[model samples]
Target: MTQRLLSFGLGYSARALARRLLAQGWTIHGTTRDAEKAEALAREGVQPLLWGQDDIEPILAQSTHILISAGPDEAGDPVLNAHGALIREHAVRLRWAGYLSTTGVYGDHAGGWVDEETPLAPSTRRGQLRQEAEAAWQAVPGLPLHIFRLAGIYGPGRGPFAKVRRGTARRIIKPGQVFSRIHVEDIAQVLAASIAQPDPGAVYNLCDDDPAPPEEVIAYAAELLGLPVPPAVDFDAAEMTPMARSFYAESKRVRNDRIKRDLGVALVYPDYRAGLDALAQDEAGE
Candidate 1:
């Protein structure tokens, strides 16, 4: 009775989750856009499939549980574009499906706390599209949809420290501006817990303990690199790309009490400090 776990758009957090599940002897299928990545995924024991191919129906048809990490591509996600008529053909067999969404859906909470019950008010096209994708999946009959609203995601190779070392760290200051975040490992754990015991149509906000201005993270990264902190720039003066600018448009402090109370999760990286310290020390070989 080994459960087969399949992930679409196996990137970032999903990559780690797929690895963990594979280690636990669960059969895994991960999707990627390129053949080389597909080969790499295969090395991890994942059956990798590319989207926009006729082959998807067979793959989607076999997955007992589907975790969508890809979100909607520029061309709109094939998962949403195609819908579940193909999946529905074998609906009785699919048990659980999870969609990784963003807290951006809550949109500009002005540092007010929010949780699963908060109504979505997205401020960006990405967030709007995510909501659309969620609705598309949920509309299918018998599809057990669980949405995880993720905060700023960081882990080993993808956090502020990496930006610091690469000389791209920017200390953008906006007084009282803060954001909640989560470690990729914690995301994997939350997904694991949800799969262990799912609540259909449940929405979980996945964020860690502290909500602090981005400047602090950047400065800490500078300290970890033993370099002077990057120069601060006011949000108004910073030259940001549309994609990056879009991130600053929303403001919120997300709550994770529900996940702790309900999923019984005691986060290993409770805050940025804990996670960053570990990364800094690991770099120093201490």
Candidate 2:
């Protein structure tokens, strides 16, 4: 049987996974809200359907696997709000379903380590919504659901190098603040592994081995670019958008043992250094 994936949101992480699945001959149908992005997805060989405007039921009916990357808002999960009933109706036919969640569901851990078993105690509204969304997805009966709680995701186009090179990078110093992160490629591998080995109702944390302070990552990115490390500003003194400031409200090191042990996956970039090194090389080549 040919594997068919219906991706609810073909964003960065889903697009990365789509690249791998498409190369393996999987029929991919993805949804986007923008006309430009739909065209881009089409160029990449994805059957793009505009959310809310296009008919997705037929595509949903035929999909063997589904990936939900659209996040929840104050109103709640957009996909579920729009198609929860339809997905549940087609649940029996789904071989595997994945939900891209965030480690934010674990909330503030005070720079401590947190595994999948950690209780959900989200400290922010964003985290709370994600936690609720996870529960909502779990409520879908008969869906072979798997949740991947991702940490800060970074890769080629989404790295600190750009800021560091532009001289706009600032090391926001929050005494003990540290965060876990995962490479986009690693995220794709983990998703692929879960597809290969279907484990219903499984939850995994996706992150690199190292969880370092925000300043360290900026400093390293500067070092890689042969530029001076940006000056450090105390968290309280830093000028930042509310969204950027919200990220510092929590500090936790997410564990990725389940993805490695259960999926038999190995991260290509286990730390910021390795991920940054590859990104710098790719930038140089381009």
Candidate 3:
């Protein structure tokens, strides 16, 4: 049987995984809201179906794997709200299911370390929705669900280098405010590992080995770009939108032990510095 994966939303990380699996001969299909994005995905050889513009039941029936990268809204998870019953009915066809959640679900660990077993205490609305979505997905009977709580995701085009180059980077100094992050490629690897080793109802925190201050990452990116590092701005003094400010409210070091131990996975870029350096190399190569 040809391996087929149907992703709810094939955004950055999901598309990366799709590219990887596509090389290995897996058929890919996903949903997107925008017509332009759907066309782009089609160009990349991914079967793109517009949400509400097409029926997903047949795709769901044929999928051997399913990945939900769509975040929940005020009402609830968009995917669950739209297709929860269908997923439950097609559970037998799905060899594996994954929910891409955020480490923000474990809010404000006071710069302390948190693992998969850590209790969820989300301080932000986004985190709350993710936690609720995770629970809702787990409740779907017979779904081979694997939950991945990802940290701040950064990669080639999405890294701090772009901000530094564009002169929009800010070195916000918030004492004791540290954040865990992961390279998007590593996220794809972790997802692939989980698919290979099917574990139903398993939760894993996906982050790099290092948890450092955001300012340090910005500074590192500047150094790599051979540009002057942005001046420091105190968190309280920095002018930021409510959503950006909310990001600074949480301080925690996320651990990826479960992925390492259970999946036998090794991260390519284990810290921001390494990740930045790799991105720089890729830029230079390009």
Candidate 4:
């Protein structure tokens, strides 16, 4: 029997995962807030189910692979608050379940390295929320769960190139600050590899090999896009939204060795330079 896939919150991550699964011959059901996206999903041959507080039960019943990439508002998610118990009601039949989490859960490592077994000490509210959600799902008996701790997600048209093109690219510098990242394509590949061989109760840290200063990524992106890199801004001087500044506050390099060793996966975009270059070529109709 073909395994069924269902995703909550049809964000880029969910959609990317769903698209790959669909292409691999999985029966997929996906959720979207807007009517337009629902139509788009339908056009892509997914079962587009309009979602609300009460719409997931039927969706859960038929799905063997469940991906919860939706935010709490748009996808009835975080599962802890809304659907953990509800999902538990159908856990018996689930082959795999994955929750998209953040490396922010590791908090400020002061440029240290972290792995799957690192104790989670999330400094941000986002991290706390993710840990809470992870715990909630883990509490359910017989629930098949895997947690993916994603670094900053970047893909074509979604990275520093946008700011560089707009002349808003600030080569912001905070000496000693470093961050990790993953391209959406690589993210899809990791998830696809996982789905091919499900591993429950496993936690994976998904990031590329590069862990560099923010300025380096911005400059490389600008160069790739054939734009001038913006003047460097001191972290203290540049105005930053709390959300943006919160990013600089944490510094850690995440390891992807586990996924590679266990899943037999190799990164298609191993660094920002590679990812941006691919996007640039794609933009040029190559």
What lDDT would each prediction earn against the true structure? Answer: 0.83, 0.95, 0.93, 0.83
Clash number by candidate, in order: 0, 0, 0, 0
lDDT of 2 by residue, 98-202 (tens): 999999999898999999999999999999999999999999999999999999999978989889988999999999899999999999999999999999999
TM per prediction: 0.94, 0.99, 0.99, 0.94
C-alpha displacement of 286 in model 2, angstroms? 1.0
RMSD in angstroms between candidate 4 and the native structure over all alpha carbons: 2.1
lDDT per residue (tens digit) for residues 7-74 in model 4: 87778877788788878788988877788889998898788877663378877887888887864332
Please give the TM-score that candidate 4 achieves against the real structure: 0.94
Residues 1-286 of candidate 1 have per-residue lDDT tens digits of: 7678777788989988888888888888777778898888888788888766527766666678888887785666666666457666755577888889888888888878888788888888888878777777777778788889999998887788777777888999877788999999999999988888888888888999998889999898788789889889999999989888888888789999878887888898999999898878877885
What CA root-mean-square deviation does each model show from the true structure?
Answer: 1.8, 0.6, 0.8, 2.1
lDDT winner between 1 and 3, please give it. Answer: 3
Q: Which ranking of candidates, highest lDDT first?
A: 2, 3, 1, 4
Question: Across residues 128-243, which tens digit of lDDT does each residue of candidate 3 receive?
Answer: 99999999999998999999999999996797877798899899999999999999999999999999999998999999999999999999889988999999999999999999
Using lDDT as the yardstick, the better of models 2 and 4 is 2
Q: What is the lDDT of candidate 3?
A: 0.93
Question: Which runs in model 2 stand beyond 4 Å of their true positions?
Answer: none
